[model samples]
Target chain A: MRDIFDQIRKRMQPPQWASWQTLIFLSIFSAATAALTSQAPPQIAERIISSLGWVFLILGTWWFVYEPDVKKKLKIYELFIGPWIVGALICIYLFGTWEGRAIPAPTAFVSWPPISAIVWSIPKFIQSDPKTKSPIYTTPTPANRQNIILVLLANLLISCWFQLYFEVQDWLAEYPSFRAQGFEQSAFVRELQPPEKRLELSRGVDYLDAAEKALKSQLEGKPWAEVERWLSNLDQEFPTVRDEAFAQLSRVAENQLWNLNARVISDAYDLEMRAIWQGPSARTAEYSLTKTCRISQARQVSTPEQLKFNSPTPPALSAQQIRSLGTVQCGAASSPDSLPQP
Target chain B: MFTDVLPLRAILFQLLFIVLAIAIESIVLQKYLGIGQKTSIQYAATANLASTVVGWLVFFTAESSLPPSWRVQLIGYIFYDRINSPALLIGLAFSIFIGTFLLKVQTINWLDQILGIRKPSTVEVQDPIKFRGRTAHRQTFSELPNRALGVLWANAASFSAITFLIAVRTILPPTNY
Candidate 1:
């Protein structure tokens, strides 16, 4: 409606500009804050610090620059948008910028640094009068429109600069191999050594080294527990490497002198365990080797339609109850004397 | 997927999007609202400008902030892996339509009041003696249906504009999405 346009025009026409000193200071502070926070680890402390910095920067800038009448506009803005900004900051803190395992991804676009440019520039745009001699808010001029647009463009550019830089920094952090390769290396140069080959070679070396160490320690008569612990300690494994590592460890355990092979059988939703000794062909004496085994959810074999593997312990066995309910007929042992179990 | 270099093309695309949106809304307003072309154009431009800036700003902010998992989920919901989900797209379109309709009505009412553009109405006394000359106006009631229809047309136009913008953005050179 004409009336709505008139009202808006009236409100915006005689825009007062914040002092140049305040504008300059605020812009510098915002960029600095963004740069600092980008360099810092994505932690709650950093989020909180950046948010508080923005909140104070806006308030402090307004206090130093604007007249009392103009300051009321800032108050209005604060009243309307303040709580949401703070809430967003709190959420950003709670959900640190990480990939998997974070609480439902909280958006960070409304955070302090990204929004600071617009918020700070709004008053500056309103107050700016480039046509005037001193550029102070004395009277509204026709050139005010052009000047305001310039100020807004400046604000947008400054804000975007911070955002782009921060984004690049985030990208660098996410891909640490870029750092390892060194920034001096061009993309074409880097492409000369394929990433897939690099990964394969590195993983191959790691696997060989780990296998050698485990086998040597085992030959020295280290307990099976030590080997198991060492295998488990290979954390931060890529999926392919993890599977390969697990397979290698299993092979080492199987080739041991006092080896125990355990089979987990699930029949009609009932789980049964059976152990067989496959080493030493001539032992007449019976030996019961107590072995501790880990039950992991089988990724390759299990499907949703079949028995689920989410539970840490099987359903057929209670925590306190341990009864060998299922019959386990031992296979013909290498020595007939050790084949007494049923 | 963005090249992480010259984003001039993206800004150009955004400008084209805004111009297209304004044109679509203006045409709808002229045809359905039964308003003059000039007034319709003015209204369309104002409304589109306000909404587009706010909408794109919020959208970019959310896009930049979303985690990979959430982004994947959102992409799945909206595009269904490029097969497209009509249900989701329509739902989003309708939501935006309703929001825009309400905002337009409020702005129009305010503008009319400020410009002293009230429609003249006869005041018919409902009950002269008991209700102290309480009156009723029939003009507003009669005009309601026409206004509602006009708004519905506006909604359709807006939906089309949004869909076009989405398609263009999707088909364009990839951003850092």
Candidate 2:
């Protein structure tokens, strides 16, 4: 084991081509740079990472290809490496962000490759031929130049396509109904809802249905003039219920706006008044008339109990309907406690 | 189920990755295969871009198929919203690396052919110097095993690097509240 260790140590000794001091310095610098960047703003960290990635690529290329075997440096630091690094940093500055914490850049992987080529091409670029001499740099030929442009165009096109795809996906999700009249809003609201939610939703639907039916039946054959009067009287009589009464009336109008079913809705004036009064609030007749109703004192009216006693006979209605109507407009049937007159 | 729609930030991140992967692959092609730098870049752009999209689709599929509890755990791991189970993270990493590797290889080959790089010469070449080295010979892409190994190595290296970077980010709590 000792002998093997000795052999490994001997083999691992620095090569003639490598500058040990420079390598150590660069490594430390890179580490320190990364550590410092860890706390920097995300944008700064991103740029630093991009730059460090390039630096690593440069070093890796040097260690693997140009240094040990060649026993000579590429020596194109000023002409190629420096400029490439600067250009790369600038590009990254413009395009890179750390917010996504995603893959840094497309060129990140290729950073070393281009640098390697440039290193190899330096000698060719600098002079007519350096075959007999040590090559320091690689040349960028016309073909290389054209290839660069084409590659750039290709990348741009791919980016545009990706952006388009992303936009389309977002659009589809944002307006799910764009595909078709998709499920109603209620369907979406109903997802993952508790078991009891079905009951609640049904109850809401029932209430809306009842309210709508009451509104339509009350406004079936009335003129707009009559509706206006009923609504105006409602506003004066029960200001709190007026908005709802008018809104429901408008819905009825709009529902039949362009249809043959459209008609000037009218109903019994007193019935309309009673329904509007009983529709939401169930105040006693005297309390409702005195405090809420806008009708004049000249109108001959009496409480349902008083009317029941005075009449010889009274109309019939179910207990539920009477409770719903909340008035004696249907005569004896509207009073649950009173016996029918013979 | 998680919404199929990707956030803008997430899409942008994928785009950035695609760009980086293409650039790196192009450089590798140029340096190792003697392909013109631009041609290599163009090939890389198409290959990497396709691979990125395919990778996301695969990831989405995996995520969607996973049980809801598992998906939530995975998403939690992804956002560092909670401490991640090592087992889950390892499994996720393995799947991601493998998925990316497979898609990348297939895409590269498909795009290479479509891009008219059907049979590039891969003549074995030695280093300029006759000395002891870690890697002495460069085999052409024509060698199927070598190509596979090369692609595997690249993908593994990239995946490991990214995983390490992400782990670091996870470990270091963001400075901003």
State which candidate has the highest DockQ: 2
Q: Model 2, stretches more than 4 Å misplaced?
A: A1-342, B1-6, B78-80, B122-145, B175-177
True contacts kept of each: 0.00, 0.01
Against the true structure, what is every candidate's RMSD? 21.8, 23.3
* Model 1 DockQ vs. reference: 0.01
Which model scores highest in TM-score?
1
lDDT of 1 by residue, B1-112 (tens): 2123222333444456557866887788777666778666655655555555445556558867887645433422321123234576568667877877776665555544
Summarize candidate 2's per-residue lDDT along A1-342 as a digit string, tens digits: 999998987776555545543454465566666666656456577567556755654554454443343343423543334334433443443445334565444444234334334444443455444567654455456555434434443444444444433443443342221222111121011112223222221112222333334444554344444555645565443433333434444222112111110112243333322211111111123111111111111222234543355555453321122211221121111111122436
Reference contacts reproduced by model 2: 0.01
- Residue-level lDDT of model 2, residues B62-109, one tens digit each, is 655876446444433332234345676578668777877777677667
Instruction: Estimate the TM-score for candidate 2.
Output: 0.31
The worst-scoring run of ten residues by lDDT in candidate 1 chain A lies at: A181-190
